[model samples]
Structure formats: structure tokens, C-alpha cells
Target: MGTDKRTIAVRFFGGAGNYANVLERCFTYVLTDNPDEAALFEWVKSNTRATSDDGIRDRLRFLEAIGLLTVDEDRVALTERGIEWMADTEPKLLFDALAENVRGFETALEALLDEPKTDAELGAAIADEHPETGWSDPSGPAQHRGWLQSLGYVERSDGTNSLTDSGRDLARRLASDGPALERGKSYTQQELEAAFGTSFGSYIKGISPRTDDDGALSYVIVKAREDGPYGDDLEGDRFTYIGEGVPSKGDQSPTGANTALLEQAEGSTVPVYFFYQPADSSELRYEGLVAVVDARYVFDDDHNRMVYQFTMERLELDHPAEFETIAASVTDGGAASIETADGEESEPALTDDETEFTETQRRVRSGAFASRVKSAYNARCAICGTSRESPAGTVDIEAAHIYPKRDDGRDIVQNGLALCRLHHWAFDAGWLAVSDDYRILVADRPDLEGYEEFSRLEGEELTLPTTDERRPHATFLAAHRGLHGFEPAAER
Candidate 1:
């Protein structure tokens, strides 16, 4: 008759995280203190490792439902039944209730009293007591262990378990009661298959990679240059990248390569390595392991298909010296470059043209940043709109700093302007300059041979970065004017 009453709860809440474990601790804590709901939650937050806000709130409702307590807004007051429970409440009462339906709760806890056991060892013991119960399943055991920890009865470390102070007391009480052990019911494989749509076995998901002729996915390369976009986005711990569109060569479906990327991003330590390099020189910098936490689908007009926007969380990185070694092995990532504070030069990065730079304000200047910036400007010179492309991945123009870095300039988009080789040389030689109002101010140098092009830029507006952050700062222009000694047209 006693076991029949327990069976009812097991039928309903057995598979659910054990209810009695949290209930015993909640009742005992309340009897000792008349804490308000908020204050009591603070205590729970500090004391328990596995108890959640929803779990505690649900248990509070349960206590009130059973006439054990009365919850009045913020205040929690114990009823007479609750006071009696405080006098002699033990963990076994709840364990016995769960054991009736769950099959292995009582037996597993009892086995722990003898010695600390690994999960495999404990699961073996649970299987011996009730072979048909799902207690041996790690998915199920995690909940049982959480329940025990919530009750402050046991702790597990390094795959071994041991009883805590509360557990010892509970063990003594259960030993004296000498409860009878019997398998309440045997859960069969058919029942398991029916419960879940899939068969009662492991679901193996794998990496669906698109193999190149060389049989490897290309590394997602980042160009970290001093004058290009800094890795400021990654410093905050989360890194987001918008990869090139799907249907990447071999697959008929758009999601072919993207599917592999998503699988690689699953929980914990995913084996995806991100590398970084500076602009100009061919060197790579190893970043670290990252996992894909979220992915979004956005339409790409370039390929007329959807591209993947992956939000990644970084795990750990190799040491700085080791990263430098890794980066040096592979080069030609075509990122922008910049000079560090210590006079160290990194990859040549890129920046976006005025339209996009103004929107993102990204200032890091790596080869990648350079590529984006050049694309924004259509790879043309900002002053004269002239550019030439080379087959060896070299441009006829170079990104020039509005305010030279040698004079304490930063490699942000706003401070950079793409110029043809002739104009780049002229600007650096102070033969030409840009006014504060963005007008071109070619110096009056009659001695120069190509006077038509130099004279053409006198009133031309300089093309800008996409966003305000990437755009050149006013103070930088003022400094450049100081060096070249050119005033705005309006000032003249």
C-alpha cells in the first residue's frame, strides 16, 4: 500500500528532475529563516550549484500546493505540516518515493555510501539493481546527480563520487529503516522507442565537409595590420564573421559547405582554427579554437543565394610566441599591414569605402580590411578615381595614411585613402594634399612632368570610408595640413 502511493508520483514526475531532493532542502532552510522571496533566492543562488530559478520557484509552488507553506507575495511562511517536516525530514522519504517509479534512485545512493565510484561503476550498480531502468544512461544519471547535489547529499569530481555531510546523516537514517528492495517495473526497449521518435540508440551527427581537390577546407583568414582593422571585435570574447556565399563550387545545394561549418561549431572544443596575418608580408598568426553558437541566413545578390552569418564564441588560444611561429609558416593571405607601438609590422589589411566604413567605423587595417576598403571604393584612387589590377594579386594603387603613422597616426579607414602609385608618391613627397573640406589641394609645382593629373585634383573631393568611425578624423586632417601646409579652399 505504501509503495502504491509512491508509484503514482513516479508515474508522473519520476523522469523529471527529482522533486523531493530540492523540496527537503527548501523546507529545512525556510524553517530556520523567515526570508523574503528575493532574499531566499539570493541564499539559493550562493548555496547550490545546480538549482535554477525556475526549479526553486516551481518547488515553492509545490510546497504551497501540499499545504506545507503559504506564499504571500514576497513573504514565505511555513504551515503547521511544514513545521513537522522540519523536525524529522530526511532525504530517503523523497528517494523512496522516486525509487518506486524510477527504479534505481535508492539503490544507487546506497552504493555510494560504501566507496567513491566512477560513473561507469555506479551505472553498473544501478543496472544490477534494475537492469531495465534508464538509470545507466548518462543523460538520466546527470539529472540524478544534480538532484543529489541539490539536496547537499553527494559531490562528484574526476568521475568519482563521495557523500557529503548531509549525505552521511541521510545514509545513517536509511540504514536503520532497512527498506525492502524490489524492482517495481521493467521498462522495455519498445516503450523507449515509442516515447521518442528515433530508435533507442545514439544519434551520430558528423562533419559534412566539401573536399577540395587538395581535400581540406580553407582557413578563415584575418589580416591584422597596425594601420588596418584591429581585432577589437574578438577582444570582447565573441567573434562574428560573414562568410562568402553557399554553393561553394562542388555542391548542388546552397547549404552544402555551410552544413559542415555548423556541425563543427557544436558544443565545447570544436577543431576549427582561425589564423591571422598582417598586410604586405606573407605570414599567418594562429588565433584559437572557436564554436558556432548561432547562425543566420541572409540573401546574397552576388551569388543569388543565401550566405551564412556565423556567431562564434572563442575557447582558448595558443601562447603569443607560438602563435607567431604558426603565422610565419603560411603567407599570401593578402591582408593589410600596420606598425605596432613597438614598431612591429603586421599583415596588410584593408578597409571599406566611404559608404560601408561610415556604417561600421572599423579602423583595423589588415590585408582583409584593405580588400574591403578597396572594394568599397571600387579599387580606384580616392583623389583621381584611377586604379589598375595585377594578376599577381597586387594593386596599382596603395592605401595611404592621411595622417602618417610616423607622426602618431592610427590605421583607421577614415585616415586612409587609396591612391595610384604616382599620386601616393606625390602625396608623401608633399607635392599634393587633401583639404579639410575633402577638396584636393595639389601644390603649385610647375617643375613636375605629369601636370594634367596633378592639376586635375585641385578641387576633387576625396572618397571616404563607409562609416564615420572608419572615416578620417578632423584632427588628423588638421595635422596633415600642418605637415603639407595646405589650407581648405574655403579658407583661401
Candidate 2:
């Protein structure tokens, strides 16, 4: 019987540094040229400076240990999956192979179908499945869950876990489809180790840290419109980054590269940095380290096909300079000045003096405030009282500012309300306004195209936040009402 998976893994990755390459090379050699096991064993011993076959056999055994090889007598062969492994360049596939060796993965996956389960509960089932091993330990389920999540097969909210769309798809595929590993080949690199049988190994590189084919870190840059995508409470921190078009033109979801990344990003931290291109700039600004949180499938109207959307979470970096860099990048352009102002640089351009806020501050505040308001409101669009999931696969609510930040509006939840696109645009255009009493106020536009819809909304009470402290600030609502010549209601 093969050794314990944990032990095999520990030894496989652990031995002499140079020897680690042997198995991968050996696998590659087999794929490139079918060779006998005796010949491969001699090849390993010759290079390893060993007189006996024991060391090479142990190495071969370890490979067999991970379900990567099959050895019968003097013949060595890579399983169908092993053949695909040579050219396949994805780490998730590596994880999938590794996960198969983990004892309780099957049981845990099945139990998750009926109801959500906690990591510990899943751990118990794992323990039951692998009674001879320590698969019942907490880490067992957590590790399995991490793989499931990383594979986009599951979603964990709070403490409970449930199957995601990808997870469900995988289950059905497993039931109806043939074995997945036997498909195709990776063709990464090929050459014999100049050995006797060649079955022992080849000289190609094994898995490296997740990176582009050229070894550079990968990144996703998104575009945010000034008043639209980016604002004081939303669209900067964790937004869907894509354009609706063909692969080269900005349609990211349909692009094959991004879809694979979205899968790897789930459950796993980012393998590359993330950046954002502001509405007007030609250069990209570093956002921060991010994790691909989830994927949503939606029809791309422009592409006229269903596309994948990747959602990401921004992680705090260690240094303050990172944020400073982002701030400077956003405010990159300079202006002519007649004279320097007191306690300020000599630039003549109006600072926050006119807009009452700088673009830099607005960007910094938008991401945080947006997350807060959405969390506070449970990600519901306040105006329509309905769920709005965007085609980008994110919560489709906009954290509309009760008072325009341009007018020195506060970036607080009380100064924000989550609105869908229609209401947000209407409010911004002064076509619809909210009263100080949290009531909807549509301007009596006699000739507007959608006059009847506005008429229907004339007295609809706004969806208020759960706590009074977080409710729309009465003063801010009054200011918004004041902008459109509507009377402010009496104070509470």
C-alpha cells in the first residue's frame, strides 16, 4: 500500500534539494519517451551517485504514493492524469491532485449538499472515513474546505459552508462525465535526462509559484468613472474590474486567462498585485494586494454571451507609502500658479477650496465607506427595496451620497444610502430626491418620459437603516432636498 499522503508529501517536497527535481524530470521523460522501470531506476542511481536501486525505488515509490505513477515489475508508467500534468501549468490542478490523496474530501463534499456545515462538523466525517489516520483533526476539514473554496467549489459565509455554482457543476460533471485527468497534455518542457531507461525522470521544471508564463507577477487593472463607479462609499476598494467587449478590448470575464485566475483566486490569496486605472489617467495605480473572493456569471450585453465576473477583496499592505503612491498617482497632473498660498504649495489650482474635497481623499474614502454602508444595509438597494446583483457578479447597490461630497459632504453611513443605478442617476440628476423624513420625492416633471413611475413613487417611505445612528442623516437629507427646491421636513 502507498504510504500515508501527509508522509508522502512531507518526504516528496523535503529530500535533498537537487533530488526533488528527479521525480518531475522522471515524469517528463516518461511522457516524452516510454521507458522501462529498470532503465529508469538505473538512470536515477547513476546521477544520484548511488550503487543500489533502493534510493531510486524509494523516490519512485513516493511518486506512486501520490497517485502520479503506476509501477509493475520493471515497467514504469504515468497514469493518464500524470501525462496531462506535464503540460498543465495550473496550481489548482496540483491542488486537485493533492486533494485526492487527502482522506475525507469525498465525504465532506457529499455532506455539504443537504445543509451547510461547520469546519469541525466536516472534520468529524473525515475522521470517520480515514479511521487509521488523523483526518478527523480540525485542520483536515479546514484544509479540505480551503481546497474546495480555492477550486470555486464552495462558499463559506459566517461559519457555515455551502456549494457554489462551480461546486455544483463539478458534482454533476463527476457523476456524468468520464475521468478528467485523462484529457490532453501540458507540453511544458521535454528532454531526456541522458539516462538508460529514461523512465526515471526528465529535466523540466515542476510547479513554480503562481505567475505569468514569463515569470512576472500578474495583475488586474480596473477603470472607475468619477461620479459613477468610484465615489466616497463605493467602487474603489473591492469592485469588479472588467470592460464589456472582446478579449483584447476589455471584456475580462469572457477572457480565458481571467476565468482560470478567478478559480485559483477563490479560497487562495492573490498570486499577483492589483491596480486601478482612474477615469482619466493613462497610467495604472497600485490598489493593494487582493484576494479573488467569488465569481458571478452574467450575460455581457456587448459581447452577447455569458461571461464570468471575478470579485476581489483588498488587503492592507504594510507601509504607508503604498497608499501615498496611490494618492499621488490619482493627483498626478500639475497646474500653473501665480503665487504660493499660505501653508500650501505654490500651485495656483484651486484645492478643496472649490470642490471642498480633493480627488485623492474621495478615492480613499469611497472604498471604505461603500463597504460599510453595504454591510450596514445588508447589501440591499434602499430605493426599490429589492436585491440587485450586478452583471459583474457583485452586489448591485450603489452607496449614493445623501449630500454630494463635492459640497463637503461627510463620508459617513448616515450620509449615504444604497441605491440601484436608476434611482442613483435620478437622485444625482435632481429628478428624484429623498425627504428629511426618509420619504421619496420625485420632481413633478410634467413632460419627463417616465412621469408615471415618478408619480407612483411620490409618497414611498425610504428604507431606513436598522439603527437610528446609521439612518440617513436628517441634516444631509435636508441639504439634498434643498438642492432641488423641496422643503425640508420638521426635525425628529
Candidate 3:
């Protein structure tokens, strides 16, 4: 049989010198001043009576032990608790930190509620109440009494000590309600539904985007796999998501769940919650709120099709500590009962068909179309005949779609043009268009900064392919010209 050892909740060191006020002062200084290790040590030495270097270090360690500060090798900074204490410098804040972190802090204080007791009496009570701490030393009890006295929770009357008015109230509250810091509890999918009144049955795959009752997008839940078809990149706090589609099929389109995610782009009212499962654990971790900063379509390889890639940034929330329940809901099971801004559980409208990847094989056909267009132009820009070759012997050319894929453009060689980076940008920006007679139609903006360069190529005939079947189609050229507000350069 294996033996189990009781773990100590918190370590309470005696001779920490100063009280809560001194700790708060130090915390405020560190937060506002942003001091380094030397600066903090010097300040603590000068401000407080801890003159020796070891004494200053001990004070800093005590602050860290109480969860007020985090002392790194090079820097010393305030923790979340320390920052909160600065905002609300109440005795209860200090009391909360003490009660949670320090062993027998409440036990000693509660013992003095009815009558006054000396340090020895409080020590006896703490030892009896919390024998796991094994605090046989007298310093442990003296330290607790000193901290309570400094916090004004307990006052010494002659030889004995008793709880103050505020101390008695806090002790009673601790006994009845316990500490304010509520630990997170992990629950299954059924339990989350019981708590928040929502169903997550539909969003079991890659991207699960849902709408509210009013037909407006509510929230999006993205399930990222570590070894999935689409590789999701996590750099720092930003997660770059590849739009929905499998590799065996075609490229990903901005439709279904992909469109739902795009709808919540930057300024949209919809909230997006990211959940990912690590390789080691079976649980899915809820990575708080994320806002989609960017979304664009790009083609990376000849084997793959153009896909919409979105960059999402994790937003800093006001009350991050309150995310314990949400975290548990996502991690325990692959479901989350999200709370809206108004603190109400939103019943997001989700259907099985809405999130299905019903995209056609257009991407598969589009990749072949791009290859034919580039090969027709001999891997050179048709406008300027600029054939840029990389050091790796790969030609730099993009197969530009005359009618964009977003507008249901057919992925045929007749609707594509092979252009270099500069002309591709100009064509996409509506600064250039194609005519029916294979001539370049510039936007004719002479007043623009880079208009002269483009205007020179206005009447230049586009480089045509030897095969008539691979040539730019007149219908697609007319669509491009009409879309860019350009008249035909030549008559039939």
C-alpha cells in the first residue's frame, strides 16, 4: 500500500518585520515605479527599517510567499493579487490573501473571537486545529499574532490578545462562508448544460460558428487539433487559423463555419472562444476570448488550393480570475456554456448542416487552372514580361483571377493571367484592367503618385499564349473591365 503525505497549503515564515501597510507601500512603489531588483532592495532598505541586504531580501520573499509579489532573477513585479490590493487597499483584501495562503491564520484569529488570549494560547489553538502543519515553534504563533495586530484585526490588552470589531466580523465570516477565492471545479458536458442552460452538441468538429435567435452571429467555438489536416500556428499570444476544409478535398472557401468566423472579423459584435487540446492531455483548454484581427485568401503550394487564413489575438479581460468556470467547462469536456456580456447564458442557434464543410472541388480544379495559366505565360508577367527567378530556381509569378473566386469566378485558364508581384497588386487594387482585344487598360489616374508608370503600359498589348484555348476569354475580360470601371481599349 502507498502512503499519502499531507501537503502544506502555505509556508508562514516568522520575523517578516513590517505590517500590511508597509507591504502595500512596497507594492504600490513596485507597480508605479517599475523598479528592478537593486532599486527595490535599496527602496525597501531606505523606506523600511530592514537596513541589512538579507533583511530586505527576506521582506521581498515574505511578500512573494503571501502572493503579493513575484521575484524573478532579474526583476521583481507585483502579482495579480498585489495589483488588486493596490486598487482596493482594504483590510479584507489583505485578510483574504492571508487566509488563503497562510496556514492556521484563521484558526488563530477565530480562537480569539470570544475572549482575549496570549501568543501561547493562539499557538496552542493553531496546533490543535491544524496538526498537519507541525508548527511546534513559538515563532509561528507570534508571527500570526503580529500580522493580525498590524492589520488591526487583533489588539493586545495587557497580557492577553482578542479580536477587534473588524477582526470578529471577519473571523465569523471566514467560519461561515470560508474564503472569497473560489477554486475552479471541472464538470462534464451534462453538468455544464445543467448550470448554464445551453447545448453544444452541434459544435464537435474543427470550427463551430453559431448565431442567436435574431439571425445575428453570437459566438464561435474553434476546436484546434495538434495533428490535424490544417496546421494552426500559435506564436506568442496570437493564433493563426486556417479556414475550414480537408486536404483530400479542394481549397477552403469563406462559407459555412468559415464565413461565420469571418463575420466576427475585427469590429463585429460576436465573441470567439478558442479551445485546443494538448498532445499529452485528453482535455481541451479554453483559451479565453480572441478577436480576429486579419482574414485573407492565399495559395501556398501547387498541391494545395487557396485558403482563407485568419489571425486572432487573445484579448486581455478585466476579470480574468472569474474565467475558472469557463475554463473547466472547456477543459473537462469538449463543450462550453458561454456567458454573454450581460451575465446571461446565450442559447446559440446551431445546426448540423450549418457547420458542415459543403465546399465543392473548385480548389482542386483551381490549382490545375493556375498551373495551366502560368505555363501558358511561360512563368512571366504578361503586362511587363518580368520573369523573376529565385535563387532556388523557382519563378516568381502569380496566376491572377480576372473574376475573383469570391464572386463565383470559374477556375479556367481563360479567366486567369500570370503576372509578377507589382502588376498582380495593381490588377487586384483596380488600378489596371484587361480589354477584349488583349490590351492593358490602366485606370487613367494621371494625378496619382504611381500613375505615370502604369499609364505607359495603358495601350500595350498583353503577351498572348500560342494556344487559343488558353488565351484570356473576352467574357472574363469584359467582367474585369466593368468591375474596375474601365472602357475597352480596342474595338473588335
**Better candidate by lDDT, 2 or 3:** 3
Please give each candidate's TM-score: 0.30, 0.35, 0.35
Candidate 1 wrong stretches, greater than 4 Å: 1-369, 450-452, 465-469
Number of backbone collisions per candidate, in order?
Answer: 60, 10, 0
lDDT of 3 at 125: 92
Off by over 4 Å in 3: 1-18, 177-492
> Can you write out model 1's per-residue Cα lDDT over 394-487, one digit (the tens) per residue?
3566667667755544445556667788888888878787766777787776777766667876777887655554555555566677788776
> Could you arrange the candidates by lDDT from highest to lowest?
3, 2, 1
lDDT of 3 by residue, 1-492 (tens): 012322122222223224766767777788888888999888877876566777667757766776888887678898888888789787778777776767778888778866789889988998898777676887677777877877788888776888876677667655642112111333344543343245768335678776667976556667677777777896667778887888677876556787776544422334465667666655555565566655667774754777778888765432222122122111111122356999986532221223222121232233345556777788789999998753222356777878765676655566778999899999988999887788888887888888988888877999978877677766677777888878665542
Model 3, residue pairs in steric clash: none
RMSD of 2: 20.8
Candidate 1 global TM-score: 0.30
Two-way lDDT contest, 1 vs 2, winner? 2
lDDT of every predicted structure (CA atoms): 0.51, 0.55, 0.65
Report the Cα lDDT for residue 48, model 1: 62
Candidate that scores best on TM-score: 2
Question: How well does model 3 score by local distance difference test?
Answer: 0.65
